[model samples]
Each structure stands twice: as structure tokens, then as C-alpha cells.
Target: MGAATAAALVLSGCSSPYDGAASTDGRSPGAPGTAAPSRPAVTPTATAHPPNDAVGRQMSWMLGQMNTDPVSSDVSSRFTEQFQAEVPPAQWLVMLGQLRAQAPWVLESVTSDGKAGSASVVAQGRRYSLTMTVDDAGRIDGALLKEGAQGETATTWPQVEQRAQLAAPQVSILAATVGDDGSLEVVHRSGEQGVRPIASMFKLYVLAAVAEQVRDGALSWDQQLRLTAQDKTLPSGTLQERPDGTAVTVREAADLMIRISDNTATDLLMRAVGEDTVRAAAARAGATHPEGITPFLTPRQMFWLGYGDAPQALDARAKWAAADAQTRAQLLEQVPMPGPGPENIDMTSTPWRSGVGWFATPQEVVQAHLYLDTLAGDAALAPLREILTKNGGIAVPDWSEQAFKGGSDSGVIALSFLAPPPQGTQRRQALVMIGTGERPVDEETFVAATADAARLLSEHR
Candidate 1:
């Protein structure tokens, strides 16, 4: 409704962002960046003096993406294979194009600490914030451009609750004070007990299930898993388009699943670990409402239920919705899933509103984040941290430990964050918000809640 959040947010896939706490000179109904669009293509802009460090190099690369600079190998070389796959070439093009077209963006200055940097740019005729981060290997983790002032004030808790409430017709938020020992004390709760459809945020539980196998010796991260016809679900990821029989390591699938919300990778991992483990994952993570989340549906099943034109698809969905958990699980195997191509799936409708997909309360998801974070502390399960942090959804300044996952369907959007307070902030924080209605999810509320969450965690509230 204001700036170009609908366009700017799309650049950072809905899954996560390594940086950018989120700023919008405008507001709109759709969840900016979370519900993904098919990768689009475009060119980049040029900057004379991008910084002189890792983050600076990324600035040059990203600036190149916005400007019409001659294409270079910097894309593949500057980013990890995982990063490249996560964002895809088309997304880079379109997202950069959106950032470019949002307004006349001029790089005013850049600040980098060798690992991470912030580039202050003037966009929409106003000075805005754009940040870039890189790993130890100097690979691009993420870049974010948003409307932020240099010394912006922290948002208050009531403001945070109000922002969270604007998400949808039924909005639920769970905010807690996170302890250094991975403990979460309830700080505030607004409809936190209500179960709402979580969309792809369900992948967190799926990740936990896989981690259990890896930890128990039943699975190995590097162990190879082959793609098959059954695994092809849909996007929010790129793996579905890969030819059948393509082999991928379990770790690769997990990375893709969490980082990009790769539906196909999620299905693969879910299959690898089985529904039982995921159910167990919910319980272990302290899910108080088991019936609300059980009978997990793969992305393919989800797609087929909402978009499938097959004769039985509609009826199956109705029966699936009415049946008990055990029967619904049986129906999943007995039913044939035949959904339309990606182009035909209607994105503006709320198919999941009828309770066709994974559902969880904000409180449960918050606990799940703590549970997953606890698992991440284990030496053998160390990879879990990398998987979760692959795409720190909202980019908060100086946050060293950001594990993010956000999901959205037509009318549903859910974002979960669990990270120790950023540098100079001692309070650990965890937040999960779920919004649902009859249209696309709202982005403005998320922006406010995210800003407030950062402030809440930074200070002793």
C-alpha cells in the first residue's frame, strides 16, 4: 500500500534472509517475500566504489545485479552452490530489478567488517538501508534493502502485539524471553493457544525428524538419496524441476528444504524419516496439540488437494479433512495425487483454510524452535544450526545466531525466529506468528512485529 514491499520483499525468498530487519516505505496485504514467485530475470546496476572486503565484494555483485553491468562469473563464484540454488538466477534478476525499479537507488556509502557489511543507499528518493553478509569462506549469505534510519528507536511491546495482530483475521503471536541455556520463558501471548495453519513452517518439524535419524545412526547427512517421480512436489524450491532419478545427499535436501522451503526436498526428507518421527518431533518439541498437526501432508499431496483437477481430488480432500488421524494417513497412501502445473495453481485462494495442511499454534511453534535450537547445540547435530540459519528470514543488525523459517500459502503466512540477542543485547528471544484469512497474507504487520521483536530482545522488557 505504500512503498514497494510487494516487489522488494519478493527478492528475499519468503523462507529467510541472512540480513535486513525489514523496512517498508509502503504497506500491503500480501506477505512480502514469503510467498515466492517463479524466478524472474533482469540486469544489475554499477557502483564506482563498493567497499574493500567480503561484504563489499557482495555489494559489487548485488549492485551489478541491479545495474546493467556486464554479466560475470562472480555470481556462481561469490555465492555457495547452496546459496545459488536457494535464490536461483531468475530470482536474483527479478529481485534486483524490483530493487532497481523501486526508485533511483544510489550507493551513498558502505561499511563492512570483513564478514558482514551495510551499504546505505538512497532509494525511492530517500536514504534506505541495504545490508550484505558473507560466511567465513566469503560466500554470499544474503543481501537486504529496506527503509531504515541509522538510529531508529526500538518498538515497544504493545506496538509489537498490535503489529502481530494486523497479520490476518485470526492472528496469533508467541513472544518469549530466551535464556542462554536455550530456555524460553513466556513473556507475552496473544491467541498463542489457537491452532492455525502454519503453511511451510511445518518444515521445521520435518527437519527435526531428519535430525533425529541422523543422530540415532539411522541416517547420515551425506548419504545419498535419489529423486523420483513421487518426490516432485512444487516450488518455493527448484528441486522439483530437476529430472527424476537425480541423486542428492540428505544434507543437500535438508539445506534446500529449510533454506528455500523446497517442497520436493521436504517431501524427500519427510519420506526418509517417516511421518511417525515428525509426529514424535512435535511431541518432543513440546507440541501440546497433537491432533492439530498430525497426518502431515507432503507438498505434492497439498498441491493436489488444492489444485488437483483429478476426479477424486476434491472428494479426497473433503474426506481427508473429516477423517481421524489414522484414516487420514491411510487415505494419503491410497489416493492418487494429480495436480495442475505450477502455472495453473491459483495463488490467491485459501485452500488450506479448510484445514487441508499442517496446523500448529504459535506457542507450539515457539517451543519447537527452542527444541530445534537445543538439538543444534549437540556436536553431532551441529549441522542442524547451519540448516536452520541458512536463511535468517529477517535480517536484524549484529545478530550472530539467527535461525529463521517463514511460510505462506494464499491466505496463510507463518514466521518463526529463534536466536540469541544480537551483539550488545543479552536477552535471547524467540517469536512465532501465524496469520490466515481469505486472501494473501499481509506483509506490513510482519514488518512491524519483526522490528519490535528485535527491540524487545535487545532490551530487558
Candidate 2:
């Protein structure tokens, strides 16, 4: 995922909507403002080329716009029509603000294959890469700023693990290779049995359940479902913005749920497939603690349960937990929908406590992935693999196919990857990392550690 999209996800509470209240502007409370600094001239590297000059100029201009009033109409004029449409001015400004908050960057070099180009830059005393595609009109059609090679070398798994062990309440990792015979072999594991809050990763079980129904001819991928006012969820998706009765296909809902961790899409799918069905699927997948998800709470319910004032919130949770699916659904109908306002609830203050959020061990997560693999042939499973591509931040060049699912909320981070080995290699592999603490887990550090660990497994396999 791009940094902007990832930031948006984090801000939206994908790990668990109960974390913190979102501001009216769609940012967390006290999010940094979009004030820009004065524009500065581009600093050319010692060996700057023509392509370098062109991209550097654009980069310099972009930085200037970001530094000064990014939301202004003048800054919006620089982007292509498609870019502007996809990213609104407010969102674009937020993204720019985040980039500026990172260390200032200086253009180093640019490389292109005629049609597309990439620029190297130094930031925070480390090198990073920015990629862009220029249209025939010389307007930027796509752009991405990502950690460069040097950033990867500066951190290692041991370093990250040590830091996590010290700073985090708990850290769990699991790596395994799928044999030709379809059995999984544990290659490495630490706290594999430790259970932690896995935020959106819980959606995988929901996906598996839906897949089984499709396989059994009980559900159709093309089946359309309508949205209601009650179906709207918080950020991380567009469904909440659509009007009532907006029809969407089962495939589309599933896609949105996995790709963006759409809370509304998740609830829609849960409602369509039946809550009991998802719970059954969890049992089949070997989830060690299915009760954690019993009487599954949609994002809205989670918010109310976690953020509603103390005594009332506790009473609601107790009643909801005691009720069956039928009664729980009725209770949900009475729950007030979330809206913009100051939030008194804060999940980050105590990350170790599991409230209404999803919880599972690394082994259960692996089991869920393994079960999904067994149903890969089912037509319903097809879109899932495709949607998962959005979450593959760690690139494994040799892997022919990679599917990923990640989750985070205030103080929790979870990542899962399913990669089929390259041609001539018969093994499939899965890697999972789960972290929890009072302090938020550093995304870049966690991603690098997971990537490095996966790399080691791939090389030795």
C-alpha cells in the first residue's frame, strides 16, 4: 500500500475502531495541520541527468506545495485530473503533511525506462525512493514515496525483536513452509501460542466462511446486496458515503473488505452469510479461542462498546455478550450510530486488555490461511487473493504469487502473508507477526522485521 493509504488506514482505526475517536475532518484528534514552509530551489546531485532534472524539479515543486498551504486550489492544480479525483484536496493535504513530518528529503538521482520514472532521495539521513509515471501530457499520473534500499539495511530482525520485547507488552511471530504433500513445517516461531488482539485480521475467518458458502453453492459471487443507513461504518471505505439501498455484489463487498479492511463491507458480508456460519468457519479453521468473536460486533458496535461512557458501555457489553446472535442483532439495532465528536475512550491506554475486539493466536491465524489455501479452487476464493495484493508491502521477488492481510489499531499491529513459491519450487509459505503494547508499534520497523524474517526463510528453504 502507498504511505498515504496506509496512513489513512491507521488514522481510521482499522485495527479496531474502538481505539480513539476520529475528528470531524476525518483525522485523529490533534492531527498535524497542513501549513507549508517556504519554497526552496531544487538541490541537484553531483551527477544529475536530464531525467533527474525533470523529476527533481517536479519533486521540488511538490515539496513546496506540501510545505505551504497544501489544501489550496493552487496546489491541486498541479495534479492530473485522475489523481485529483482519486485523492481529494483534504486527503492530499493530510498525505503531504505526513510526508513533511518525515525528515526533509533532497533529490539524489532519477532513473526511467522512457515511459515511467523513479527518483532517489535522501531523508532523515537515509536514502529513499520515489516513483512516478508521467502521462503523454507530461503530467504525473501516479506517484509513490517509499523507503529506499538504505533504510532496509539499517534495521535487522534481531534489533527489531529486541526493541519490541522491551517496549511492547507482547510480540509474536510465526514462519512456516508448506510442503509438496500439503503439510506445514514450522521453520521458526516465537511466542507462537501467545494470543493477542489482531484487529482486522479477524476478517480472514469471515472471508473463509463466505468462501465455503460459495464453494457449497449456497452463495454466488455476483449476488447483490443493498446498503441501509444502519450498514454505514466509519472510515477505511467508501460504503459509508453511499446512499441507502446502494446495491453491491458479494464479490465487490468481499473485495472492499479485504483490500481496504472495509468495516461496512465486513458487516454486510457477515449479515449475508449469517453470523453463525462465520463462527462455524472459525471452528473449522482451528481458531483456538472462537469465543473472542462470538456474537460478532460490527465496527459500529465495537465503537459503542469501547467508547460509550463507562458504566453504560460495560452494561451494554455484558448484555450483548450474554445474548445469542438473534438477540444481539436486535441489540445492535438499538445502538446509536457513531458520529463526529470528542472521544473520551482510548484503547491505547491499555493495549493488553481484550474488550470487544477480535483475538487469536498466531497458530490459529496460520490455520485460517491454510484452510483458505485448501479452498483456493473455489470461485469465491479468487477475488480474495486479488484483493490481498493491496497489503503486500514486503516484496519477495522470487515468489510468483503473494497474498497479504494486515491489521492495526492504537497499540496493535498484525501482518500475515501467503506466498506460493516460484516455478520449480514446490513449497508454499506463510509468515505472521503480531505485536501489542501501550505504545503504538512502528509500522516501518515491523514491516522490515517481517520482511527480513521472510527473506531468511525463503533463502534457506
Task: Identify the leading candidate in terms of lDDT.
Answer: 1
Worst 10 residues of 1 by lDDT: 18-27
TM-scores of all candidate predictions against the true structure = 0.68, 0.74
RMSD per candidate (Å) reads 7.8, 7.0
For residues 287-342, what per-residue lDDT tens digits would candidate 1 score against the true structure?
A: 77777676777777787776565556666667766778887677566656643133
What is each predicted model's overall lDDT from 0 to 1?
0.67, 0.62
Q: Which stretches of candidate 2 lie over 4 Å from their true place?
A: 1-53, 64-77, 86-133, 143-169, 180-182, 309-311, 314-335, 338-352, 379-393
What's the alpha carbon RMSD for model 1? 7.8
